[model samples]
Structures are given as C-alpha cells and as structure tokens.
Target: MPALCWNQRRRDFYAITTDVSTEGIRFRSSSRLSPGEDLTCSIRHIGLLEARIDRAVGEEFTVSVRGGRSALTDLARQFVALSRAQDLRPEVVRVHHRIVPKQKIVQVTLDGGLGVSGHVLNISASGVALLVEQSLEIGATIQVGRKLARVMRHFTHGVGAAFLEPFEPSAVHEAMTL
Candidate 1:
C-alpha cells in the first residue's frame, strides 16, 4: 500500500504498507534487534530510499520515514510495480576465518630474514588480517600493506594486525590492487 526502502546501515528493507494497520511498514529479518538500530533502504522503482529502523515489533522492524505523503505515495507506487517484476536468489559464502574485503597483498621485508609474503584478509573499522606464510606470535610486528602492525592474535594462516594507528581503506585498496 506504501513504498518500501532498504536500510543499508542496518542491512534491511522496509515500506509503509496500508495493507497492514501499523503506521509504519514491517521489515522482516532474523537479526537481533535493539532499540534505535540504524536502517537503510533502496527503492526498486524510485531508485533507493534509505531510512532508519525506528522500532522493533517482534521480528518485524518499523521504519521511521522521511518525506511527505505525496512522495511516499509515489515511491510506494513505483516499488509495487517494480517489485513484482524482479526475481532475486541470494547465495552466502562462508569462510573458516573471517575474510576482509578490499585488501592488498605485499611482501613484508623485516630487517632480518623475517621477510615473507602474505595478503591482507579481513579489514574492519579498527583492524586488519595480515595473512602470511607464518602465523607470527601475538604482539609480533609485521608489515601489512605498508605500515607495521602488531600481531593481536594468530589466525589460521594469518595474524590479526592491530595497528598502532587505524588502517585506512584507501591505502589498503591501493595495496591490494598492487
């Protein structure tokens, strides 16, 4: 009955449906919900409409929408028309060690014969995975991309690089491309 949008932040989709009696549309997901969790949305018909998940009612999320009634109506109409035309089948790729994306591979050349080649695996808001030929002991300093990070923990074939400074995405992406 109303338009639905995807919450990119919370990784969910939502819409305002008159089909149901609730003031906001229902978002269905299995993820644990806490109050004030962020949400984002994309409109198939109206392009992308992002918003925050305002509330959680059981397994359904209620979105806090922006824009006026006319805009909402237009977006809803487009969503309905386009939503029925698409078929989406999603697949998941799981790994034993959490993989970080958009990373680069480089050869770490220490002062001694500790030089080794490895790749940057999982990257995060705080750290990165310096996958290497050897899993260095914790607190060991290893070169990742360009900077040296201490080995926070030993993973399967790598060590989590805990930077004294944060790992910048741009630098990591550049290193990975090389």
Candidate 2:
C-alpha cells in the first residue's frame, strides 16, 4: 500500500509498504532513516500510525508498530480492500480522459519555499503534467497558478500534479491558456 513516512526531524516523504502485520511493517523509503527513530506514517485512508525503526538496509526498513491492535486490524482491512479494489478496477479507463496540451509558463512553489518555473505539458480536470528542471518530492503540496495541488508522480522531463479539487474540464483549459 502507498504510504508517507517521516521522522519528527524531517518532512513527510513518499514510501510503499512491502508488508504489514500486527507487530511490524516493512517499507521502502525515498529518504534514508536511522534505526531506533520514531516516525509517524500516514497511510492512505488508513490514517496515521506510530512506528519505531527496527532496522535499515539501504532503502528498505522495518518499523515496529506502536499503535494498538484495533489500528493494526483496521490497517490490515484497508490493505485488503485496496487490493481487491485494484483487482476489480479497469486498467484502461484513462484512455478516455482528454489531455489538452499547452505550453504556458507557470510558477510551481512548494510549501517549503522551493519554487521553479515550468511549462505546462498538458491539462485535464484531474491533473496537470509539467516539464520542469527541478526535482520535486512526491506527496508535497505545490502551488500551480492559483490552485493547490499534490505532486503525484514524476516522469523523465518533470512531475505531475493532481489538483486538490476537481475543476470543470473547460475551466481547466481556460485557466491553462496563456
């Protein structure tokens, strides 16, 4: 399951759980974390879980679960639900979503004050992909034009952002026009 893990000393960054159980969870992180460190992980829809780093081997680490059994049970249920949902989800639905290409220059500013100029590669009601030079950390909220967006994924040229709220399709096109 997709997750975000960050120790109190750092900002939230992206991670994916390799495995999870009542006693512990194993996951891979983009950032290096030290053993014995306590961290909070916000799993999608599963809320936050307190954890202590058990060990680190390169990017993969195990964290001892600090939350109660109820939380662990809920987390396990969420994982199973998400897995089933994925199995039931259609794989080709994105083909019908229109992608409008435009080259308007825009400013992308992260919540932590990192800013970069980027070219809008395409715009849709769901999100916009930008061709940017600076590397952006996934899961960070960024300002795109007037709308707040979350960095969802990265590509060779840049990053993609999903808007905080869905916009009217035409409204997105109008806003992206320069």
Candidate 3:
C-alpha cells in the first residue's frame, strides 16, 4: 500500500467520491464554477495542490501551481487510501422504499466495438449510469433500452450519461416512493 497525505481541516470531500474531472477545481463563495476560471484546490492526500482549468473534458487540463505535489496525484492517492480503509471496516445502511422503482439492465458495446457490461448504477427522471464491465471511449455512444447515451465522461466504476430522452420526473419520483 502507498502513502497519501491529506488535510484534516477542510470539509470539502465532494471531489473525493466524484468521478467528474475538472480542468480546475476551486473553492468560491458562490455555489458554481464557470468554464474558463482557474480552479485552485486544497487536497487532503499527499499534501498536494493543483491549479488548472478545464482544457477538455476527459483530458488533462493546463496545470500550474506554486505549492504541494501534483493535484491529480494527491487525488489519486486519496482515492486509494479511502478505498483501502473502507474495505477494512464495512458499513451498510438501508432506506425503506416508498415505491418500487422500475429498472432495466443492459450490456453495451463501445463505439470501437469492444463489448462491456455495466449495471444501471442509478436512474432517475434525468438519466442513468451504466456501471460498465470495462471502460469505453469518452465520446462513445451506448445503447440503453433502445435509447442512445452519448458518453459524457467516465465515473469511478462506470460512465456518466446524459439521456437522449429524459424520463418522466413524476414517474421516477413515484417509483422511488414505492
């Protein structure tokens, strides 16, 4: 196992579990990030700091920072550490379903013709994530229950998708309630 250094002070852990890659990640007073703004982040692992902006989705952005190690490295280290720690002690929590949700599982072939299987990690009125058996190209097109999903980006265990046809919000909500 490798060692990772992170801060114990900052509470911004959203970047940790998320698979979204940003050219830059910044902490600002506002609740949003603009496309062109430089992002500065304080990472909790490996005492690394990074400065970057979105150069391109699913690609490396321009990185320049004065202090700490590589932001990407620090983040990667934290991920490894967190994953190992979670494995040691297991915890599970369940929330009762108010409505029985409807879901469909499917396997998709990459645009390059590589076949992979991913479970529907989640689905809502908006979209779903196919927790694929293998990684696919970032811009790959996927077939989901006759619908198409253009790969926006890859998450830790799967890829994210913006549904070509959004599901009905009420139906999703009702399904969750069941």
* TM-score for all models, in order of appearance: 0.36, 0.45, 0.37
Q: What lDDT score is found at residue 146 in candidate 2?
A: 74
Root-mean-square deviation per candidate: 17.3, 18.2, 16.0
lDDT of 3 by residue, 1-178 (tens): 1212123333333233234223323232212333344444544444445444333333222334444346555555566777687677645232222222354456575666655555776665555666776767777677665556778777787887766676556656533421
lDDT of 1 at 174: 30
What tens-digit string does per-residue lDDT give for candidate 2 at 77-151?
888887887777555355225565554788888788787897888877878888888878899888887778899
- Residue 86 shift from truth in candidate 1, angstroms: 48
Query: lDDT of all predictions, in order shown?
Result: 0.56, 0.80, 0.50
How far out, in Å, is residue 174 in model 2? 53
lDDT of 1 by residue, 1-178 (tens): 3344434454443444433122544556556565565555553335554445577776666665556455557666665666576655566332232335554666765435577887766665356766677647787766655666677777678777666676454554433432
For candidate 1, the lDDT comes to: 0.56
Better-scoring candidate (TM-score), 1 or 2:
2
Q: Report, for all candidates in order, the number of backbone clashes.
A: 10, 0, 14
* Regions of model 2 farther than 4 Å from truth: 88-178
